[model samples]
Target: MAGVPEGPEAEMLAPNLAYQEGFGRVFLVCAAGRTGERMRDAPRERLGDTPEQERGIVRDEPGETNRIRPARLAAVEED
Candidate 1:
């Protein structure tokens, strides 16, 4: 039910299969290299910030520690 995929193709496919098979929520955490870069660049809505605004904020952050702080604390923090 829970394991790492054998490769990229498997990683992409597994979440869909898990969702189709009735998993309430399927999360594919690809946090390395190109995958991580793509995800970070991808637009997402948060705290009423538009995609453009979010992108700008990302660009303005000075370092990785600042960049990742919001994401790492998001689930636990109310705001």
Candidate 2:
């Protein structure tokens, strides 16, 4: 089960629930505010990267575009 408790209520109370057999992952998606800033890095490994990551940059970026290019395409010469 996915438990999502936000703000102070979740921060103060969520830990008390404890992670044993029954409790699944407690995913807290809080507002990106002061409270969220304080909670940052509480579980770095578990949270992965911030939500800002991979948000705006399009897949068609010139730099990133060629990285995925197929090498076999160049081998096919046109008539």
lDDT of each model, Cα atoms only?
Answer: 0.46, 0.40
For TM-score, the strongest prediction is 1
Residue 63 C-alpha lDDT in model 1: 60
lDDT of 1 by residue, 1-79 (tens): 4665666546555445543344233323334344643543322212245447545555554465556767868956865
- Tell me how far the alpha carbon of residue 7 in candidate 1 is from the true structure, in angstroms, after superposition: 25
**Which regions in candidate 1 have their CA more than 4 angstroms from the true location?**
4-47, 63-79
Per-residue alpha-carbon lDDT of model 2 for 53-77, expressed as tens digits? Answer: 3232222243444543444356554
Q: Which residue pairs in candidate 1 have backbone atoms (N, alpha carbon, C) closer than 3 angstroms, thus clashing?
A: none
* Reference-based TM-score, model 1: 0.23
Candidate 1, run of 10 with poorest lDDT:
39-48
Q: For model 1, what is the alpha-carbon lDDT of residue 33?
A: 40
